[model samples]
Target: MTRSVETTSSEDSELSLPAPKERRRLREAAELTHDEIAAAVGVTAATVRSWESGRTAPRGRKRELYTQFLARLAARRQDGGPAGPPGEAKTARAAEEPAADPPVPDPPTGDTPTPDPPASDRPTPDTPASDRPTPDTPASDAPSPDARTEPEQLPAEPPARVPVPGPAEAFDALYALAARDLARQAYLLTGRGALALEAVEKAFVQAWDRWPEVATDPDPVGWVRAIAYEYALSPWHRFRRAHRQLDKPPAEPADRILLDALLALAPANRRTVLLYDGVGLDLPDTAAETEATTPTAGHRLVHAHADLADRIPELADVPLEKQSALLRDLFTALRPAVDLEPRPAAVVRGGGERRTRLWTRATLSLTAMIAVSTSYTLMTAPTHYEPPPAPGESVSGVPPLAGPQQLTERGKQLHDKLRADPEAGPARIAPRIE
Candidate 1:
């Protein structure tokens, strides 16, 4: 079926998949190159080529835009709206060529162990102890009658008890719920199914590391939403690298239009509006979700409104004339973008075993190499081989020659010194002076 939403201004063609001829005509009418359209939708030029070739139809936002782009073209044509210059389209297309990939850092070297910084540099202060250690127990007043050597006993106090929710239970509940909500909001704002899922997953991983604090918060969902929004806008998310090849934009005109509109948005504005209006979060809550102040969030929402009014004029009037329609159009347009289907949770049942197997293999390989090299060296060397000495030099299992005599000499000297002193070692006892 034709995935694009129907509009009054233009007739939509059949939607089994956009025909190559229909897509080309739409592209020509919109004055967009395949690359330009692809860049707009954040896909690869190859993908765009595929769409035009009738090999595939753009899914998600690209699918949603099929009707919207044509309608916009029809509207512009009717109104004689000045088409943006040809050079602008050409320049944008040129900019879409894949750039050089960033250099990946090498994995950590085994030679260098990560050193722990000194305790003094640690964030929290250490609790200092009192001058004297507390005694375990005072001397007992009386001994037991059962035996003369019976030891004195001290009374025992009951163990102290604390009451609070279990940390892991609370943490799990907050993370699971907040993560799901954040993913939904991301899909709504970006309108890209994969992007929304990624944003949610990224936010949850980050939250996992700080669950202790986040779980205790009054609004964990808000916190997760904010994190997801930030992640959605990150440079990494902006450019998706699948396999070794760059993204190819969808070829269909509708897909091109939708992609272009989404790309036009500044990340912050898109995130703010989605988190606030789309997810029904208040301004303060939106700010919390986006990690911004209320004023900043308010400004983003305003800019988002302006951006919407400037681009996509069809949806604009509804929002302007009927506040409800504006909200409805936004939700409708964005719903496909952010829609996340039920997914199986990631399972790592045998991860430990796999890791252990890998380590074992690596160790065996390394050991084999070392043994081979050592054996080669020993075999090739000159033939006069001396076995290592036994632990002790003396026969009959007696210690080495320097052991017993030295201890006996030390003991004799100590005894002679003690006997030579009048008070054993000149005691420091108080004297009766009188």
Candidate 2:
């Protein structure tokens, strides 16, 4: 009597999953590097390498996700699309190039070339050529004849020209240049791609609101990066963590363990390590951003380094100066996989203002109510009634007469005694009263 064996379709599918090496081959064929595939699969590059080396394999949902991602990547590659995160290659290219100035419109030209304006009336070199009034315009349109004649007296000191890059333009330029890098840093801080992008967008919105101040600052990128870091570390994110699902599958145990160790440090220590080691901020700058003294920031960094070294002994051999670069590379390789669309500037600003106003109003109302209640209680409360002192008695706990009649009689007696003893000594009156 032999028992027949039965297997469900799901079991069969699980059994038929590709070997770890095969998976790696598929990913490589799709033009995806270990880090790229790791990001797509929400695991560390080490885990991807482990998979390729057949030392470990993804299981359950992660295995399914890895398969799906590879398939999609292969399809995209076949279609001749770039095989990495959107804008990633472009951002890298842009960083390699010189800072790009905003595009200026070409100056309008007529059939004939116009001669340059006179030296005295010539526009400054910094001014865009298009902004200059066309010399070809009729004399009537070239400012009022009276105005030109009046300005001929002097150049009027160039109208106290403002800085060329206005706040709005400066902010736009900075956003274009630094948004990707800022988001990447945020991802390192938060270990969640969506949260990181959200934090960056929020920081940008704040920067936009205060663009005049931010643009004039010595380090606007640092300012925005600090904001993103603080936003990523907000406690509110913990509550949202469970609800915020990643598009990519869960990370491997080693990756998860490493992230847990990093996060287990105190917030200050974690922030110090991330900024100093991961983001390459100097102690003073990190201190300024974290609102600590440089010495304190340094201490925090040391402790953080020790903690990390305990978890990852490989870091112990890294040089002090190169540790930052090493940590940065590590985080970049492990960045989470997600693409985010930034909220519109207007929407973000409006929502932030609404929340601030609501909070302000609530706080003011609460304070006013407390003040009113306190005032009412103080005004209506019963007061202590201290009786008037009787004759021959001080208010300092002196015993009073038994009755009003007794007090009047005592006063009368004292008056009579004093009148009778006008020529007598005060000792005689005191003896009589006793």
Candidate 3:
């Protein structure tokens, strides 16, 4: 069962191979079929599989040969050769070459590298081979090149490969930071928690859909905020069932009053005030966001402040220019009556995609239907034209088509005379002699 090859030394008696899993991977990568490996290793295909699977290992001469074969495989792989055994010709040629008189021993693979000796002990152009300092010689006995390491002291660049955020990651970061706050603001506008959350989610969906524009925008958050505010303030929402009824008021009397005041304002005025006072935007910004002129935005803001101040005495004391601080503080103090949780980024992105798909399908279907209808009308229409009838004309003496009149007595008697004698009728009518 154990046969040792003549050339197999005690050191080569044992073999070291990769782990079972790694062996399988390497074997597959080498394009070595089970049969090819089995033939090369002088074993059956099943035996090769067993070896690779860690079910068994070769012993004696077989183990030695297997180790050599693995070394050849790795060497061949490193050399980038075609999938085949590493050539023995090179190994044999190396073995046949002459050896130097003083053989330098190969370094141990696991040992730490020895430090370089001083420059003086190192072999220079004039130094003899025997006189040159070896690793065993002390560094103090040699010399140092402190100059070489001094250049490393200057400041180096910041670490490279910083892993910049991708588009999706950046989008998610923006959403995570802004979604909750945006929803709260939306709730302030709509006075409905669910609608507020829906508005923010839909806004994010659109933002993701147009991410190229949104990402490149100088103020992505503001872009998203505008969309959310527009959706929350949309008049069409009033027709929906969810928005038809008033949402429950907040617990705090002050917040409830403020929310009521806000909701009562026309959408334009409310948005302008929210942007200017609550969101801390300037008049020009508020005007831009609300799609109104600066004067109009200011007008709305002054009126809104007046209205709110009328309802809330605290705001009434604050002047228009100073109202922003008070209003922003009041809005911040207002707690949402309900939990307004915005959807995940994934959900918003996927919903946007789905909505786009449905709209695209509808548009295509409509186009197809129109094309078919036009085609059908063209195919089935009458091609030939019948001549139109000539218009009627009025004659000079033609009487109107009235029913026949009753016969007179003279005509009746003549008719009786003709019936009595046919010849007398013609002779009386024809001659009429005196």
Tell me, by lDDT, which candidate is best.
Answer: 3
How would you order the candidates by lDDT, starting with the best? Answer: 3, 2, 1
> Which is the leading candidate under TM-score?
3
What is the alpha-carbon RMSD of candidate 1 to the true structure?
Answer: 42.4
| True lDDT of residue 394, candidate 2 | 43
When sorted by TM-score, best at the front, the candidate numbers are: 3, 2, 1
Error of 3 at 24 (Å): 70
TM-score of each: 0.37, 0.40, 0.51
Local distance difference test, each candidate:
0.57, 0.66, 0.74
lDDT of 1 by residue, 60-95 (tens): 344556545555545554454444444333232333
Which regions of candidate 1 fall more than 4 Å away from where they truly are? 1-180, 189-192, 237-240, 243-260, 291-293, 319-325, 332-339, 342-434
Global Cα lDDT for candidate 3: 0.74
- Cα RMSD (angstroms) for every candidate in the order listed: 42.4, 23.9, 29.7
Residue-pair clashes, model 1 = 19
Q: Higher-lDDT candidate among 1 and 2? A: 2
lDDT of 3 by residue, 71-190 (tens): 666665556543434322233224346777666456434476766656754578887877876769976665444444446566787877878888789889999989998999898888
Better of 2 and 3 by TM-score: 3
